[model samples]
Target: MTDDDRGTRRGEIGPTERLAMNRTGSFDWDLDTGTIDVDEAGLLVFGMGAGAFDGRPATLVQALAPEDRADLDAVIRHAIITGQTSYTAHFRVDMEDGTPQWTHVQARILRKPDGMAHRIVGIVRDTTAEVTHSDFVLELERRREVQTSIVERTTHALSRAVTVDDVTAALTGPGGLARLGADGLALGLVENGSLNLIALSGESLEILDDFRSRRLDRGLPLAEAVLSGRPRFVPAFPALGRDFPELAPYVARMRFRAACYLPLVAQARSLGGMALFYRGRTAFSADERNLALGLAAIVAQSLQRALLFDEERALATGLQETMLPRRIPEITGGEIAVRYHAAWSGRQVGGDWYDVIPLPRGRVGIVVGDVQGHDTHAAAIMGQLRIALRAYAGEGHAPSTVLARASRFLAELDTNRFATCTYAQVDLSGGTVRAVRAGHLDPLIRHTDGRVGRPKLRGGLPLGLATVFGEEEFPETRLDLVPGETLVLHTDGLVEQPGADIEAGLAALADAVRTGPPQAEALADHLSERLWERWGAEDDVALLVLRRSPDPGTPRAPRIHQYIHQADPQGLSDARAAVGQALRDWDMDDLADDAELLTGELLVNVLLHTEGGAVLTLEVLPEPVRRVRLSVQDRSSAWPRRRTPGEAATSGRGLLLLDALSSRWGVEPRGEGKAVWCEIGPVPTPAGAPST
Candidate 1:
């Protein structure tokens, strides 16, 4: 090489060599001659014999593995041609023993004074162990961070899951298995000590479905995990051929060589197992195993909680249904409809009941009551109270008498819970109603024209507080139901919301009832839906509606109509029943006993003094004159006559008894028979009746 080409910078090569002498190796390359000179350590790093390498650039390049030779040569040529300051590269070289060793090379060009390319001076170091260790650590850290994030997100999802299906989706959905690097997932719950596959993801579903149908016991990774309460890891699919040869096709189709079965254990109890699949054999790290175990624990706990809630809610629903009446009494002259809405709190039962009892003499008893509690105990008490009320009312007691007796019955039981109730007796024939309240909301009356009114009732103490006394009796309120008017009785749950004005809810309820559909059924349904949509009160609600419409032939709302036959002495009984029914329909059930007596007297006179069967007809006069007219016709020309009974004269005093019991009595002679008629009063003096 020429002097200038030798380079003044190259004169300091001795100092550069001394600096690169320890640990690392040093080398010099003449670009013009394409010759290389390496120290002993440099030759060792390049995988060349101590004195075997000639001073040739090709020889040095040939020592490096083929994969790295071209890139290293290009870097060296560029540095020399452009007089680049420095360049570094890592490459591999094959040792004499055929073992590959990794090396790092750093080169700097020694330029001439004219700034032309001259010689290249460089150092070489063996970094095979350090590079391999660093890459392995970095990869492990990346995997750990990824798995930690996935586990955290999965736990959050599981926490929000409130049902079994939600739990399954969180464990096997796209957000779950994919993040965990699983190819397919199968979740098997340990129910009744058996592993039953409930959810699956990816291609494993078909295989898992077949496996579940087989009902195999033992020899399965999932079963083993659940039975042992530990995780089972299968490193390779072929390794399972001996134990589970049936899974070969599944493994092949899913391209699965590795799998993990983890038991979902919580509080030391094994609830289920989770199966994870991978495309190739995987050596699970301790971190991965621990992460999976934690995930299983969270899933197990969430599933257990959701399952328990479902069971409790079902039980509560059953109890509540049994406590409420299934059907209302089918009566005439009016229509009765009932509705019940349950509380929203899970597994919590409320004490709300509605009943319709058809009593003797055609009087109907309607009750809406609420027992204080939010559990099974309340439901039980409500059922008992409902039965007691029905029994008392059916025994021919008046509305106030029935409620007072019910209150006494509750007090005798000494149950800590109290109850509010409203009892109403509707007289279909009399067109009158009597209601008594025991610490309950007053009944609402909705007129056909959309006006609503609630009477100012005096409330008594709630049942279970004390025995009913003369002064403490539930105060009675009487109403003359106008045609097309409805009486609404509801439990407090319908109008009471938590931390809100109760009066507002009551006004809303009254408005809904007044403006609802005219038909009883449609009105009841509409009011219930309105309550649910407006406040969604979390308490149970019970509504009972009784509507009295205009005359039957006018095409108004639904009403009841019944007929009975009259024959001999049975005819007298039938006559009483017919009048009683009419009286009850008219809401004058209080006058049923007297009316029945008058009808019985007339029917008996026909059966005893006349020759043929009698036909009894009972009818009601609406609004302006609320009266029940009872008439019995017999095929006899003899008309009834008033006679003064001689104490022992049971046969001749029929007309006298009818005259004394009824507001009006008369006998009209027909062509073939004589008709005896008696009429009961238009109850509640006209001056006392509410204005339309």
Candidate 2:
């Protein structure tokens, strides 16, 4: 080869020069000796001069910041301890020119026979551009996630807001600010061309109350946004204070660095405005401002929906009240109390209703009913049916005729709706209640005493259903209410509970009634508080309590009454306990057992053989007899006779129990019923008690 060709070959670049030109460097670290050897490229990557490095690990480490140096040491130690074959790390080195240069490192760990690291061969490269790009991408992703979370959670929460108050509570309640990703929040509504602040969320943001009600002037950023339907962002507190001096005090107390005000615009009009303040951020990026605007749009939609719901609900409630009776008439011989509750779902309007109408000759007709559904149509049908039913009863029709005609009336409307009702014609002068049931719950009678009973009245199908089924016969049940007795008529909502048997609800109602005050208004209130409120008032309820005027009889002739339901397990025991207590009070304690036993026997006979229930009355005979008389009355007219049964027979033992326990027992005819009577006392009076 010629001299020129050989010179050109020697000047050609090798692989080592190529790697150095790519900013890649190499190092040989003798781990055992704690010494390192670095190439020129590595020294350049570390921002160290040849004179500054002395072939030791500290020489290169000195070029790194203290935190980066510690981090690199930790990476090496962790790799050796975990028996790794290689290690990788990224860090920043301080350069001679006082600028930070990002560097990436890769090393190969070589171990001895005992598995201790002997040497590390590694490479270093300047990674400034790559790391900067990666960091930018990561930050963008973080912002996107935060903005997405704010929109998603806020939308889900506002979806269930049914009223304006609900929307307000959702935004200001616990965890609201944190979920909204704001250090502080302010909300205001547009009312009468002015902004009325309704919500302020933060630890000390209530200090902003001075500008709570302000005009749409540019002096306040939020008001200005609402006026123009635009958003304003203040990236620093200085700008905030300079723009609105009134907000300076609150901004100081809020300890916020940045803020954004957004207008809540829906369909070309502003409904409200919202303000978000940040303690950590000093500048608002375009992405951040756009996120605030999107949140404001979501809030605007929720507010619009809630306003519409409130408007429609008010209209429906007004319609419901207008259809009901203007005022309940005062009956001559009784005091009446009524209660009504609307459900909490949607609009709070339903088909439940109650009415009281005055009839001929001191008779009052009371009705409690429920149309089929909960919408406005059902309520409309209920109004028409109530008026028609009242007309029939006021015309002096029988209770049965009133309900039957009402059924036909409902069916003639030709709507796909049915109604269940219990109607009663109460003759207060004679203390008589004639009631008819149309696929509704039976009426309950609370005795002069504390015991409560339900009478089994036969019922036809529901109103429209009865007519559709070609049968409209509603049987009447005749019940004689003694003076001071309370008759209760209520819709099913009063005693209905979710996921539970209807029987359990009825038992609870009876217990609440039995232990409650005897006054009509007080009893109705008690039932409402105990049952309806406890059940969440998920359905509409209508309740009526009518208390016959008290007849304070002669003191010596005081009396007690109780009704025993056939389906009640506690009925027999309750009746027994009541009778025994009465006998003790009348100074006839010696006959308590016999009186209790006879009372149970007669009640059992009526309950077992009859389809309905029975009423037990215990009276102290006035004057010289000094005897307690007990009578058990039921709707069945078949007189109970003597029955001979074998020892093993369980049947016909009720009459035998009565025969064995009573002093003298006889059956007498009552109003469409039969009464069994027995006497218990004439006992030696209590030692020091006066005999009447």
Candidate 3:
């Protein structure tokens, strides 16, 4: 070809020849001559020898394999007619040795001055190795992507496993073992230094269940795997019976031939081991082993977290139960019913508590309070605050003062949390209730006529808020509980559901109170069940119901009465026996020891000081408030007085001892003698005004 015909081509001028010479091979085509010229390397790519054939377009076309010749010719013809700048083709070529390999040809069309194709310059190379290597890399990349997906799904599924059953389900269920290329799984946990099977799945499940309640000894393969904190694999697991004859029975039932035992270890602690099984012999690959180890680790972490959460939840529930009052005391004029519901989803214990403290003068102090959080911290704070409120109320503080003291108590702890509380004192005899609020929901009042409404009460800031800013004031709201009226006190959890309007919850609560059963116990149960069904508690709920009891037709005598003769030391013993019996009759055996001691002291005082006979009386008053009153009436008019006796002096310390043992004591003038009476109970305010 002439230099003008080949070198003057526009698209394939500079660097084309140099590039082709160094890497592939170059070819020059003269459209006018209708022939092509191939370099030495280009001839090798096409399996041709020098001068073996003329470089005609038809001859070059014959070199391409049959399947590629037509398409390559079509492109060359299009390039010549349209003046296309570049064209590329990949096809198979036959070598002289009868071997087939892939070849790639890239060519540029050289246009003449009139925009017509003058010549073609091209580069050619055998790309069989590159294509094969690219396909291999693509396969490896796809497999890696699949493995990553499996890991992500395994972790995601295990994340919500809160129990052994949940973990087992995630492991062998649809996407778990199958995705990980396993057919079955067994999970064994270390309990009391022994490996115990707690969960099993898949076709090999029966083999694991055979030892479900039994501990695997050190000789067992599973136990050894966990103890060593290493992975173990068996291509034919059924053959294990030959080494350990004791496992022959379980091996006979196993459906899987291959198995892998991976330790479930976290933070250097071996919590358990996971067993993966396959129906056919599996020579475990590195990727398979790695996936098993990773899955085991994830399972260990999830299981450990769930177990700790359950432990904490159980502890919190126990504490809450222990902190709550065991039973509601039967008051003289009213009955108290209480219900406590913890959140169903989380910690199971929350910061809601209710208490009924019997005040002086036949009055009952009712309290409902809620701390800020739903965790153990909040429950602990609730406990402390509940006890403090009870102590303050028992000291005979008014509703307002009691709450004020409680607020200060919580604020002083510096826990950075707040509480809302309501404290109410119900005088059953007077049918009056005085209540004070500390940023708490209003109390619901149900009238005797079946009408219910929330009582409007002025409230101060929540407990810790005022202390952070300044002093706080609690306002009181007083109302009379008519004959059949009942008061409902509760934490906000009862009336405030998640994302619902507070007013709506309040109205619903009021409606439930009005339409529920009339009796305190039944009404309390009804409201609890209904409210919980309507709106599951996301927080803790504390509900207290106090209702006036119907008047009894006749008055009942004191629980115990006795007459003691002069010079009768047996009277003291008899008095103690009576107190014990009375306490037992009240189902209060827990108080027998204290009651007996106090009764003995009073009777001894009567026997030591008085010469004449005395009347002993023990009575439990459940109206207006609940209290156990013991009185000693003697013919002697001498009244008993409290005195600070010397430590060594025992004779003059009876009254002093009585004053310390009893909640309150006084001397009263009777028709024929003087009566010394003392009260022991949750009876209101030991420091406030005495009973009228």
Candidate 4:
């Protein structure tokens, strides 16, 4: 039928009936006989006369080709005997021109109300073109699925890669080119007008060198193919014998006949190219080319990311080295070993640091501090605080005084940063340590006999708080160490970790000390190993170990005496008698005159200030230095202020005389009274026979 006649017939049919006929191609049939009553296209398709052949044993076998007649006859017989709804078969039909055409036929058995057998009404259509088209579409779909899988796998491989070498290796690896049915592959990087062999698969280095030595121009098959920013397929290398004679011999040896060159371009930068080689003269289809180019783009991006990450790692390494202390100081008499461990992984650099400062009066100050954050800023702040702590300790200040000055300096610092630190001064001769804590973890002191103690001291507020001065006290804690005793100072980063209690870390440290390594280096190594084992330290860890040596001489205690002044004459006599008693007790009677003069000035101050009763007190103690402290107690709470030479005050003259005669003097508030104290130095030995 004409196309317009078919369209008009389709339009005349009702929408629902037309849709049903189009789907099933149903038609009327004769009841009580197996015969088709009407089939619009049956005469043209079957080359049969257009008349009903009722009760004549009509069957589809008449229209079917001889080779399919048996199968169609069997299907129709089964449907007729069992009253089955339908039967289907594929058959070839002999048309009017004696041409055989493949057709798909479906028949249904219909029944009348009286249960009489009805004709088999069916539809048949020529299926040769449809079947061929279906097969072609399926083949296309299979190729599409293969290409999609290849692209997905290649993209995944590229994403996993983290460096240029990684990208090159992945691109040229067994799975990469082999997935595309390639026998060999080569990856090149563009450099100095030549393609350098960055990577290769299934090829020797010598072969690659020989291939690259041809010095092919940029517009040649390989370079031009990639430089065009498109994938190019070389069907056969033998066909290019005239154009590339040098490659012909090698191509024969390698048994490579075809190749595909894919460019690696990203962000408008042409980095390099990849070549896939095959054994036969096979050219990739359009889909294969697109897949290869897509994979190349992924490889390029992965390589760039890897290079950037490498650069960042190098920069971080340099920054970390510069932030840490270059060298530790050399201390005399005692060995000082310090260990600083930086975090090996992650983006942060530690701010933990330690310093061993030499203080005046033969004492060494030990400091361990941690800035709050872990970054470049924290490292910079640590450096500033370390230098400031050393400078403050060098000024002959006690541990508390040094911490106080450091706190003030850090608080007033323009950066307005904060840090936690512990400062201690060790007197090598006496094994006496004076320490101050500023919101820092308490250091552990392990005695020689396996006793561990954290000294009792009030922790000062951290620096940078506005009200820190009032809330925090740099209380000094003194520790007396015997031979083989060790003091461990560390930052919290060593002990504090996620998912673990801090007490566990402390217990671990204590157990480590109990294992017993007496040397400073040995002890430091032990502690460092143990800390690393348990805490898996996140921040940098800094440790300082100080051990005391055995004392060579016996301990000796000197006598200290103090006498305060009173208003009465009896008070003056009482002060003199107390001074005499102190010297006699310590067997230092030769300095009686010096003690008497010091007492006179102190007593006169009480007499001048008090109108009534005043008190005088004396204290004697054995503490190496024979200290004579005199306290003249009065009800007045006022302290004596220093007076300049021109500023005249008759009462302040006693302080001047007291300052001149005594070794040390100061005023401190006593219960209900203020005490002015003075101490006298020991008497000089005659000719230095053995200093008493």
Candidate 5:
């Protein structure tokens, strides 16, 4: 043939010759005639000599594999139908040896003037090598994606763990085996040179029970991995009978086909090892081995972190407990219960404390307080504050004086933290509470009748802050207990509900107390369960419940008592109702009006002139006179004197009215306070009252 007919310039290589050298050929397809014209090189891709191959399109279709036949034909049909400029398809052709060869067909559609396709023209190449290389690259990418996904999932699951048990549960809990793509798994933790199998998942791994605890020096594959800080992959694990005869019996009955043991190493130190078993896998590829190692690394990191966290928490909480009261001092005349809790959230150490101190004359000092933080520093400060406050109260200081000294003491500490506290001097015999606050919540009183009240105590700033603000004066509030009443004092942590109003927390606390059991210890537990347990408290809590001994009177001398606060306008009316009821209960309704009048007069006198509340007690004297004694006691030391005032004075009539309504009246000096008492009697008394 001439050089131009051979597709070449006069002096250069021909196009068809160059295409043949590159293993590429050209083709033309006629849509109307269903005919194909392939060059010699293209005939070679069809595995046939040009003389042996016909130019019919059916000839190429018959050569393609059954599954690829329709695809190759549909490529051109779709291009023509959709008006596409070109189309390319990769399909497998059946070679003479019955092997499949990947073929690439790329062609441009030629349309008539009206856009109806009539022909196609394209070059052909034998792309087996290219397609095989591309497949290898895609498989590599898929394996990489799988390995990365395994690592990400393992890391994500272990991130939330903060303890050794937490890490173990993450690795061996439900769905843990499936997440790791293992039919079974065994996890070990190194303890004192021995590996302890802390977790096991799936079946057929029960053989690991024999090695649940083995020394690192032991020749077992898992233990060796931990010692050497390497991985041991058993590709033909089922055939390990010759190498490990000890495992032969177990392997005979095992359901797994392959296994791998990976060392858990962190900071160049081996913490443990992990073993994964497969059901259908017979071997582990390099990529899979690396994936197993990566998972081990994640578990190692989490286990190490959790171990250190547990150690730190133990040390912290131990120190905290050491600083607290080892035991509460037993006291007579009343029962006292106290509870203390550390912050949850892994802190385990905080500044909350509760203390009971004995004072002179059968009185007890109770303190509940919280320092400003949730760590060792706050706990240290709390320790010092608690001891110092206890000493101050034990030395006969009043509640206000004790808290003021405590505030000053905390201000002098080495820390910059402040604290809030409530201190009270309780006298069970006198049924009195002289309480003071240093920026703490007011104490709650659960009365004998199951009603709860929050005493409105005056407060200064927090302990250290009080001195900083030049406000070290904590005013003491006097509260009357009336036998069988319970006094509750707690740190703010007990009532601090996140995102809720402090007032709402206080209301909930009141409701809990009103509904809880009446005993001191039971009520303390109830409050702890209701508030601290329910909240999973993020801050430390300290609670104290002190219930006075009951004073049930004899049948002949029935008595009733009530506390009246000057701020409680309703308390004044309630006090009057209680007194009348008591008198009637004693079958002396004849004296109810007079006893109530005396109670009102004396209670009004105390509420009006005193700085705090008063306690009123009415009891029948067992003497034959059938006399009813009414007494009003207040923390105020001022005794009432019978005073006469002008009719229009509108004041100073309390004592004068008490004198006119009662048979006799007197004033007695009590410890830290005074009592104004009166007696009401009857000449025409009922039944056994006066038999002559």
Candidate 6:
């Protein structure tokens, strides 16, 4: 065909058909009637003769290489049998020089109405360079998969470790290290200008340490690779055999003919290097080098995290030691024991503290308090408050008064912090304890008889309330403690904790004391253990136990006397005789009858109005006072009212009799049982008022 005919045929086709004809430079083929159509680029690619040739029409199989002829035939046959319009394939074609070149063939079959293909029109393009480039990319991708698998397996095994030793064992143990295809491996950490042997896979620690202790020159293969921020592999040691003879023994012992050293870099900092040894003289592929670097990075990060944790624990422990009080003072007439326990195995240093201050008049002030946070600031605030409270108590103030002053001091101090505190003063001489509570746990009093009692006291607001001019009313409460009674004061951290109800914790503490040993040390230890067991030790705890000393003057099982009398004067005389006989029966012959006359007058008033006679009960309690209470009940639905002496007639003489004979008196209503009580002080006798 002429060039004009070819141009006309190409113009009649679509844009895709026109471009397909123009891109035929990489192939040689016959067009139309078996005439060779060879462009200049196509002639250069095939290196074949370029002349018009007269021959039969060339079939699609004519361009296929000898080895790919069968595949090309199969594709053509399928297209013809299925009446497919076209078939395409990638195959190699034999060139004129007997060399093979890759080619892509696309064949179009033309069929008649008889279902038989008579003509096959196709295009062939050489793709030798493209196919070679594509095969290289596929090979690299497969190698990447192998490298990723190795890194994933190693990291998964290492993450299961709970301790540093476990991590090292997992990284260096036989199965774990061999899986990475290293004949022997050494982990070196940068220390003192030389690599310190942290771990090794197939070498003794002594050998590794000795080798690492030698000065690692910066230009050494492993050291240079780390410093240059790239991996280096020594394919053979023969090149450096003469320069570094000392490495010959290590190389032979480790069976390493080839070695790859990778730097452990994390966050732009070089930690050390990991040396992977190979038994054969084999070089690492790019994928193997990447895997080595990735594993080294993971090791560096994990080691850094462990070191940081240890440093944090050291700091927390040091802060706790400085925060807690070093010693507590020895109290006179009382045995004081204190125990402070910080929470176990955590970084929090809580703000629980206790203090004991000696006050004037043979009294000791005790305090247990907790600030509102769990850090250094909380602890510092606790110390400041403790010092301020002690200073106030030392100034001869009552327990309630001391707390009020301390609250004001905290409110006006530099810090606007608040604290819950329990302040108590034990009067050794009087056998009484006065206390004030400021939003704190109530201290428990364990009697010598094994009975526990919580003293009645109204709790005030915590410190720092005075900033708003909010007055903190500290209710002063007094309790007469018997000899051998024990008092326990503690912060809420001792009994209150996370995941535990406060009431349950309190009950647990009480049960521990009830069932455990009785000594102060034993009791504190048992209660602390019970608390930690239930609550898991989430906060700091402080405890103080005070055991009251036995008093020599206290009576044991003193006698009690009751007298009932009518309203008549004869009954009053009879009441006087009952009092004298009771005192004498208790071995007290020094009793005077004048004190009994005052008691009889108060009882006669109740008998005159009520259907039942009056009841007068007297008992000797512990130290300082012998109590005598007179209860007068009447059926009248009227309450007692105090009256002026000038306004009332002779009927007011009953109250005057109570006021004259009793040290204190009060009236209280008890569910239709109204009682007017009169307490008489111990009378002065020759033998120190019968020892009260």
Number of the top candidate by TM-score? 2
**Candidates' C-alpha lDDT:** 0.74, 0.83, 0.77, 0.67, 0.81, 0.66
Worst 10 residues of 2 by lDDT: 680-689
RMSD of 6: 14.6
User: Model 4 misses residue 683 by how many Å?
Assistant: 30
* Each candidate: RMSD: 17.1, 7.1, 20.1, 16.9, 6.9, 14.6
Stronger candidate by TM-score (2 vs 6): 2
lDDT of 6 by residue, 153-260 (tens): 777777665344556777787587655666777776676777666777764324555565545566455676667878777777445444456554554445556777
Give the distance in Å from residue 514's predicted Cα in candidate 2 to where it truly belongs.
6.7
lDDT of 4: 0.67
Which digits, one per residue and each the tens of the lDDT, describe model 4 over residues 541-573? 888888876433222333232323343467677
Give per-residue CA lDDT, model 5, range 64-153, as digits (tens): 766677777677677788999899988777788887677777889988999998999998888888988999999999978877777777
Any residue pairs clashing in model 2, and if so which?
none
Q: Give the total clashing residue pairs for model 3.
A: 11
For candidate 2, write residues 1-692 as lDDT tens digits. 86556655999666677778988899999988888999999889998777878888887778788888899899989999999999999999878899888999999999999998899999999998888899999999998999899889888888988788888887888777776788889999999878999889876677888888888677888988888887888888656767788766566676788888899988887798999888899888888888888888989999998888878778777777787887888877689999887776657578888999998888899999999998889899999999999999989999888888898999899999999999988888656687888889887888776668787776789998998998889887767677788888988888887897888888888888888888888988998899897653778889999999886644455577677888998989998998888777766677788888787778888888899888888776644666777888987879987878898987777767766766667776553477788876565544554666
Q: TM-score for each prediction?
A: 0.53, 0.74, 0.54, 0.49, 0.74, 0.47
What order do you get sorting by lDDT, best first?
A: 2, 5, 3, 1, 4, 6
Evaluation by lDDT, superior candidate among 1 and 4: 1
The TM-score obtained by model 3 is 0.54
